[model samples]
Target: MNQNNKVKHPKGLTFLFLSEMWERFGYYLMIGIFTLYLKDVKAGFAMTEAEAADLYGTFIALVFLTPFLGGLIADRYFGYTKSIIIGGLMMGVGYCMMAIHSLPILYLSMTLVIIGNGFFKPNISTLLGNIYSTPEYEDKKDEGYNIFYMGINVGAFICNFFGAALYILLGWGYAFLAAGIGMFLGVGIFLYGMKHYRAFDVKKGMQQGDMSFLKIVMVILFPAVIAGVIGWVVPTQVLGHALIGSPSTDAFIFACIPVIYFYGSLLAKADKSEKRPIAALLTIFAVVILFWAVFKQNGSALNTWADRYTDRHVENPMAAKIFSGLSLSQQLTMAKDSVPLYDEAFRLQKADGKVLQEYNYPTYFKNVAPEKRLAEGTQIEVWATNISQSINPGWVILLTPLIVAFFTWLRKRNQEPTTATKIAFGLLISALSVLVMIGAVYSGGNGAEKVSVFWLMASYGVITIGELFLSPMGLSLVSKLSPVRITSLMMGGWFLATSIGNKLSGVLATLWDTYENKANFFWINFFLLLFSALVAFMLLKWLNGIMREKGIK
Candidate 1:
């Protein structure tokens, strides 16, 4: 390879970027609408806020958890490329199956996605790290991951438009089908670029002292399944109540015990040479759980915020026209007889098993000022609430280059922050984002009024910067520090922490309705992140010392 080409990103980065992009396109599109689909009064399952958030949380938690087995299998049996292909196809089928309305089918579809993502997510990341392992690309590894992160956002940002259009033009099922198509497209792209990464798909089969595959199946997988079943059945059946918030939550937490122990055992049993780096990675993993706990709210609690609390009206006619043309906006009329009525609390009123109230307007108009309210027959165009899910990805697309350039400039001056330091700052910056939401809550008068959409945008912008700093850097850090034989397994550990946090996000979201003073809810989030950032700062010296010992900057 030419020196210039070596210093720049490898050609394989392009294919990986595109492949990950379309994969996220499908995944995020499905996620963006998941709770909404579950709660839709007509076409959906009519789940309550707590019920929807609980299921959403458990679903995503399991989605991240399966990567543990997936990574281990790829490391010991299959190569990265083959695992990625299999995972992609499985997810594609899962997304398409979600189009079916039956609950049993929906559960089956979710199972496919959860299992597929396990195989897909960690290996691709490990492969990217491998490609940068060469001497020339080594120095630019952080930059490579940052650029790859941009590709993820590019797909995430655009998928909502297609989802909104498909759902609005046809129905929810069509929108889901599009997610499957995007996933298949991603798998095809990965296959097309296989030649570029084929050499890097090196699998490190079972090493000395490593448990045999059958032993792992007996020891880890079977125990986890059994424990999970106990967690699910014991609470609701024997105890006659949930020990946790729900059975699924209990089951997930219980299932994780065995997996978490497995990772811990790795640290305990590792050779002395690998100890400190593994310790550092595990420490960082533990701390970043708080970050994901708060950040993953973009799908659940934040989605609810956008749907019911944010004013999404398009005041500009040209923008409205464009949005309408794209099927990204819906027009609502203040017609007396057409809209359903809910109480001041936004709950439906029923008497004798029949809806008793006949309010003449949609629930969205409840918080409008009397003066601002339109005439009875007037129509207003508002963007789809789910479309707000795109804001974080939109900010990522816009700010990634600037963030990359700023870091590059710092690198040239020999003043670039260590990856660990960037992550510490990422936590602190993300904490500030919660304060923004608190401000929104205050501005909205504790949900008594609708707030401007700008608040959501601003919060997402602040957090996107934090995400760019932390998420990709974490991936690079894992790649750099992990032992060659166990790289993918450690990658699985990273996702495990993410899995815990995602579940906690759902747990937090279930409390959304219980808080009368909503700012208090956000305040709790702020404190969690702030504590994590403080802890990260406290450990900086020790973490940096480990990095220096490894001869990495």
Candidate 2:
């Protein structure tokens, strides 16, 4: 247990991994309940699904967008450890403020998290890469990132239970408060381990031929601010609020224009040596956007499916009791009679005595069949829908070791696929996960029946493999390929791709209400993924060539 002489990965790596794990646990916990909390009529915001998805998309997109600046600032002025601590605190406080429920306060809180993440997320990851850059651990960089990535999923996996319990036990506000607490704990852990990584947190201090910080602020940050203002102030409802999209969404998309331009400007201004690295990074970033677009739907549209369509009732006594007690159970039943519910299709209708969409307290039971339905007078205390969000992370925790070992074996044989190839294959395999949803559609006959939870589980299982393949490798690739001076900034670029894709996923999910045939929804996801995979496959040869030329392979 000697700290400095740790075998394989560095001690700093483990500390950072655990820090990120807890931070992500809190972040994902907040996200897992976010839209659901918004849409919950009782003890929730009572927003429609579409409204909630739009806001969720916008929030996540902006959360990622800020890292572009954060990374740059860290590389130039602020040290990595400092940035991470500040960012973590900001996010922790934001989560706590979400408990307030005031619109202005909620917005202020979200802004804090977004800005805080910009500082914390990219810098810690860059610091990890910096630690691995040492000659001793250099060979195991990819493995380091893979192991680090498992921490993220570990947090994501465990947060749902906490979120469900806090929300069910107390209320949505308390659940949100829990997220803040988790974030603070993460910060505390990271600070405790600061000595482990403090040596590597040195600032690069504006590398040779790099863009001057002030110039970037003028050209990029200022423009982004102006664009956001225009988007926000322009009367979307010129006469009434008739903008094509919501103000928040339009503002975010507009803000991205300047930020996107800034990244493009990097390519234009780069020296010959830097150009290839930047070009390579951009190509990979563009291709992976699709993977994120589909994968991130777990929050919006897919959550709705698990909440409404998937039959989550556990018949097994042990499992059912566990889930029910954990506040993660879902109850499903069949409503033979036409039930009055508040949906977009019948929003204006007033049939039931209760004005708000009133039906069976347990919404899942409404669409299920009699045979499968719980006996009358028998109340099934089932798990919460948000709990399903944990499945992918659960799989990641289970499968990462096996996947890592498989790759390690491949490395020994001098036969490991390059990171680019792994990412390409990940995209292809992720496309397959969508088909499972398509199957769920057919099996359930366009929502005329209740689909088995197995379909949801199976779809998640397939996607989790793809996720393990792509996500960890994507981090490894950026770390490996990026020039030392701009390492964290490139990571920001990677997150930028994710930001755009996250928004697109939200856009795609929001369209769920528009699709009459459920299969069409999944097909769209499939095609989007297929197209992304094809693009990645097309770039594989060139990317591999770069990897080999750089002596990274």
Candidate 3:
């Protein structure tokens, strides 16, 4: 585990790190602006909250689903390196296609990106784990994935700034072009590392007693597709609707039924020695879905908080200079004049028992003096809101080193928690981040005033810590516990958990407009996390036994 244990870590690690950094850079840049792009009157699609949330949810849900297919292919035929290259290229192309702005092209582009991600996402992690499986690097495996996660967030953190610059200085097309450029750079970085990882990226080619590729396609993929179609046509709440949040989400949820069943069947049929380990991993995966459902809202509901409720007023003359000079700050007019921000797609009742009326979303600018509206004209200018997406990734880059060192200290003293224990605690901590927002609700007083940016910042900071504990550790846990032959397949299971959570995040975000008191919105998230945390904590003793039986400790 020590640096001195080997001459050095593999060069592939550094190359893959840079590659992932740039890929995430492209991906996050798009996501940071995704909702804002949908809702923009002049430059965006002019969609309402429910519409955008549905699309965003469906987009991310499908994004995670592809890994299910991608992992299968890489495990059998294409191998890891080729799959990564192909996946990266497809995604880069998809990023470029976003510039076209046509809905049909958008769907096609999303399909490409989804398939690309499926092939690319899980394999890279599996590849990194394979590299670390060697004795020289074995002890440092957790640190390796931590560093890798940092690369992802570094890309995520910096991309928003680029997104801001491109959008402000030019237009949406230019910003999307920037994303495409970042994606290509990631591919270049990945290609540079090919020689280093060529040996480890070997194909499994189906071992003895393993299911054949054709059988997986016929029994799993084909059946899942048929079932998804049935789910689409079925007259059920989970389906039977054209809304982004309905039939599509339902179809997706239903599609997962076969895949989920397949994993369970794998366990039912697992050899006696492998049963405990697989069961424990599945247990953790199921519990953590709630965590991701709430956590993934960063790009949706939380993003809305930063855009609307949070007071983005940049005082401190020097701080304004720094942000404004770089085009990263949101500048707004102080005049009493209304800018007519249109967030309300549905009707709302007046507070004083008047008839129902839906109007432009009232802004914090409404709080300014009426006379100031004259000098500012009837409309006001405010800095763009998409830039706030950078906060979480910023926290990640700042905190990863400290967290790793803290855990290292714990390990040395034999005080390290079991992986399951760390995940349980992660769930608990993630729950508290919701409470931070509940405080924001209390402070904002029903949007009569803008909440301070610090509230959102503080919330993201706390949640980032929980994300660190859960996310990378989830990857490490799967690698550590999965049977070697099925590692990538199991990693797909982890992403499957994430896929379901992401879809649910969209479903949750779509409810934002319905909540008359946004504080209750966050309270709902709080309870969801609390429930999941309780479930994990209650099962901890049983989970620990399985971990012990499987020799995971």
Best by lDDT: 1
Candidate 1: the clashing residue pairs are none
Clashes of each: 0, 10, 7
lDDT of 2 at 81: 92
Candidate 1: stretches off by over 4 Å? 1-14, 126-147, 195-200, 270-274, 326-345, 349-362, 483-485
Off by over 4 Å in 2: 1-15, 129-146, 233-244, 269-277, 328-362, 374-376, 480-488
lDDT of 2 by residue, 1-553 (tens): 3543465778888789989998998899999989988777666666766678888888888887888788888877888998999999999999999999777998899999999999998788889989988778777787788788778988998899999888887888998999999999999999998888898988988777566889877887799889987777675746456254567767767878888887888789888877887888899999999899899999998898898888776768887778775654443333336433322133322442223663444466656664665554455656788888998888888888888799889999999999999999999999999999999999988886778878988999899899988987898799898887667568778988999899888878778878989899999999999999999999888888888778985
In model 3, how large is the Cα lDDT of residue 348? Answer: 47
Candidate 2 has what TM-score? Answer: 0.88
lDDT of 2 at 85: 92
Q: Model 3 — which ten-residue stretch has the worst lDDT?
A: 335-344
Give the number of colliding residue pairs in candidate 3.
Answer: 7
Residue-by-residue lDDT tens digits, candidate 3, 157-232: 8898889878877888788878889989999988877888888997877776666778878877888888788776
| For model 2, the run of ten residues with the poorest summed lDDT | 340-349
Residue 114's lDDT in candidate 1: 97
Looking at model 3, the pairs that clash are 66-118, 67-118, 311-451, 330-383, 331-383, 336-373, 337-373
* Per-residue lDDT of model 1, residues 288-349, tens digit only: 99999999999999999998899877779898888784433323343344452222334554
Tell me the TM-score of model 1.
0.90
